[model samples]
Target: MASQPLDPGNSGRNDPALLRLPSTVRHRIYLFLGVARWDGCPLLFDLDGPVSPSDQVTFYGLLLSCRAVYTEVSALLFSSNRFVIHYRNKRSLQPLRNLTPPSLAALTSLKVVLNQASCHHRREAEASGACCTRVSGCFTRKPKGAGGHCLIRRPHKNLHDTPLQSSDPSARLMLEEWRATAVYLSSNTKLDALELSLVCDVDQKEVEAAEHVVAPLLLFPKLKDCHVRLCISPNSHLRQLARNASRQASSNPALEPASPTSGSSRLLITLPREVRIRILEYTDLVAPLKEVMWNRLGLGYHYFSSGCSAWEGVPCLPPYHHGCQYRDCHGQGIIKDGIVRSDQLRSIGCFCGVRHAAFSSTCKCWAPPTPLFLICWDLCEDARFVFFSANRFVVSDSLVSANPWLAYDVSFTPDPKWLLENRSNYSWMEWYRQAQPPRAYPAHRFAATKFLREVVPADYLGYLRFLELVFPPYNHECWPHDGHPALQDWIDTVDWVKDKINAPAITLRLVMAGSRMWHPACPDDRGGLTRVQGIAVLTGYNRILKPLAVLREHGLTRFYADFAWPWKWTNRVYERLRAADDPNTILSWLEGQETLLNDRAERLILGEDQHDRLRSNEAKPGPSPWKMHSGREY
Candidate 1:
């Protein structure tokens, strides 16, 4: 039964003469009858009928009207794409293989047993549709990993069963069938999209097994859309491993996850960087307003690291072997003639902001929050006569100019010898320019850069002070001013491995810096960027200025402490580290704080694995997030 959109009078239900029409006219009439309908409507399924209480009998009679009518309508009658399966526990989803249209008969028991789960409309469905069933609010829920709710339960749950193992195998068996059916449909060539639920654990073995299970089908050539809800226990080795994998995937688009976990309320599992970026690119990321991506734009790493001619000029890498040859040119590797994919473009556009922020990197590096102002300067100096077509700054201008109500400070000024430098000095850009778009940021960019140069340096700093006043640099605040606060981006810290392959530390810095929208008003969705590890939005100037403007200023001014591992304590940790065996390992174990950079700086300077090994029988960090409560979460 479909929700009726037309009145019985207007829908032409009164005319018995409609039944006297020829078969072709009748079929066409039926097609037009169910415009925009998705329910169990007779016309929608291509069957001519006055559907009623005797639906099965009515449909069968229509099927016997004639061979021609039955043939055309029958094809559509069985074309329902949705299927449900259920199983008891996580297993190789092989039972699903039999559900192929050819093998669907093998799972006949599925239909009989799980009929209650069918989405068929009910007389009271609309009336019973209640909101805010969960007391955690409709949006939040307490499930396993993050700790279960000892509090009252949510009444209106999207998932019918519980997150924990069910006591009754009846429910478990039904769940197993559903999972198997999903796996079966996934391998189907015509499946445009899919949805599935699975359990994830913090155990390393679980992560490996999960990957192994999906490895064969994950490589599907036509598979462009995927949705998965997988949750695992907290502090599980698998969770950390997944987090690291996501971080590593910042440059790899092919590996992103398809969907948020069940409640969509809580994360079921940790996703790798590329996958996380993919989700961010598609999701409505509105909270934790202080995220670097919202403020600094360059955090869109995938765009820069890609070889799209539109972004060829920005420096970054695709995901690839740490020491692979040609690591600089093709991070993960590129194929000729591929334009910047929408995913990459959105990410780049999001950072540097399609309007105001511009590309600014030392050519090969990424990260450390560079103030929006400095990145503008880097673009001004790079190339003077660039075309305004390929870059986002132009698009942003168009958007802003159209909306006069949006507050902005985009006016720029040009430098006297803007084009004289010729971009010959930068190491990565100089060599990579052969592959980049021949255009630069244009003379107009200089104006914005210039304005930022004269006006923003202090004002923007004032904004930081305002945030400090309003938000307070609680756990970690003011990145690029120093290493970072606890839980900083993996990008700010360099992948010593990549540097080891590209060049040396000689004044080069790979530091974490909070990022924000380059053009705050721009609406495009670009995922986070950081070529070295997943999820980094980059800025050419930030790469240059973080050390120069932000950190240098902080170190030179000795402004204050209270940043990533704070400047003073960072030194003490290193001193303690020097005395420990397997210092890096010991440092990893230190739980009290979740500082993001101390390890990278040490790795960059001390050389990889050069630090003393700290022998702690227990491999863990002190003051870990599990114990110390710090920072606000949305």
Candidate 2:
């Protein structure tokens, strides 16, 4: 046979032009070519195969280019991507054991899958009918009497046969390997996130054994997010182990007293109290505390804007649109698309809009100073004081409406539909009942109210200087109505605040929107307020303010009600009312506006001529001034 020609793949290794580039430049080139992109999925590794099934074909050519090329890019391949290894047997972890020290040190994220096969050696030993004598609930293979056979014991009842101290030689070896692997990972790897998933058919005893096997890995000090999943039960001993590890790691340095004669701790202690506090402030310890409904990883704030508007003639577009509140506004879309179509103006209607912006917690501009609180007891106290006293905590209507048990309970597995809705990444209005179903609010059990009551420490409540409670826009049919559960929940929350927070300046804000009218074709596409619907707005406004009376009680005079209606002229009216120090001014202004709104409603209902005249004027408009410069779009 003729000798095989040299492989083109191998030939690339000697390419002089590519090899001449600097290592940094070559690394970027490899990354640009998609060598490091895993698209949020973990990179799978299996000891049985040279590479994972998903990547073997794709990376084969590049990796086989030459040993030199592999040496340069292997670090990037291992470090930049998250690696997951599945443990099936004693040798299942060979892939991890094979990684070089440098490659192991560069790892940022890792996940390990432990399954029933991990205990195969123990199962096999039991199947072979090995004889043993029980001593203190543990089975040993040595005979009790000379020349006498030991009695066989059932493996299921042998709870002491944990992987770590198993009678079976293979089982003990496997545990040793696991311990060694855990030691290597904890000492060498720089993991930010680690997950240990035990998806095995296991009883309580087996579960405990599995926990022992993974305990060391759970104690990795540098992890920011550590998750342990036990398929047999909702709770896991390993989960508690992970928590203890996290707590110990965070407090270890501070637990031991620093030498008074030397080190930075002494220098820190020497500084004046004011100077230390000033330095802490610069560390962003005073970030706002806000509530989030989904993927809430740590303490941080999210920003969102909401508004309502009324449109004349045929409504311009959908009632709800998600984008920049001003630039891509649905109301503006009507004007941009030309309000006058086929010599007719769109009918008048109401629009309610809300848009979610970026969350500050995930932004890389600054790291959370929560770790600073764990540095020392004195620092922790100072951090908490600055965090609660200097920043505003906002409790929104959506937070109150959410089912806290479902959202906050790690053990509770929500319905598939609920999970899909939250994970879909759709732009949704948190306050809208149509988008987010409201939980039946119980006075003492409401999620938001309960969080304020029980979750926040009592001492921190005293430190609070500013608190903002935001209620959804008033709906005549629902809000402040007799026996409304949500209304009761709100009242109970205010009562709790009054009782607990004595000195904090409270801001009560009501979001207002024009009444919505559904389009003839699409039920979900709603229009802005009509003349008749405007009456409901006035009635709703009057009813909503009745709840604010609870805030006017003794020691609660620091509170003020803000009616945040987004309409230009309406906003100015509310702004002027807000400028007054007395609550009586707001009530008086609402009374006057209610009377004027009622009069307009009556004329529009009874007089056809006024409706025609209003429509005629709307038909003459080029761009509705209200839509152009709404008080604050979003």
For model 1 the local lDDT of residue 91 reads 31
Q: Which segments of model 1 are wrong by more than 4 Å?
A: 1-84, 88-141, 144-188, 191-205, 212-221, 232-464, 468-634
Collision count for each candidate, in order = 90, 10
After the best TM-score superposition of candidate 1, give how far the Cα of residue 561 lies from its true spot, in angstroms: 24
lDDT at residue 240 of model 1 (Cα atoms): 32
Evaluate candidate 2 by giving its C-alpha RMSD to the native, one decimal: 19.3
What are the per-residue Cα lDDT tens digits for candidate 2 across 1-634? Answer: 9754443443465465555566656767776666665343223343345333444435546667776676666767766655555565334578777877776766655555443311111222232211133211122123333233333433333222222223446555566666777777677656543333222222334445555554664556655444333222223343333334433333222222222233564566568777777777755565422212211221233222211122344433443222123321212323423331221211111111111111111111222344566767776777777766665555444322221111111113355686578776522232222332222222323334654666567667767665554443332233344466655765676666666665425432232322112111011211343445445545545554454455445344333333323121244444665687885777666556644553343233324454445445533212112222223221
lDDT per residue for candidate 1 within 130-203, as digits (tens), equals 11111211111223322222212322223223323344454345445544544555455343222221222112
Scored by TM-score, the top model is: 2
Each candidate's root-mean-square deviation in Å?
25.6, 19.3
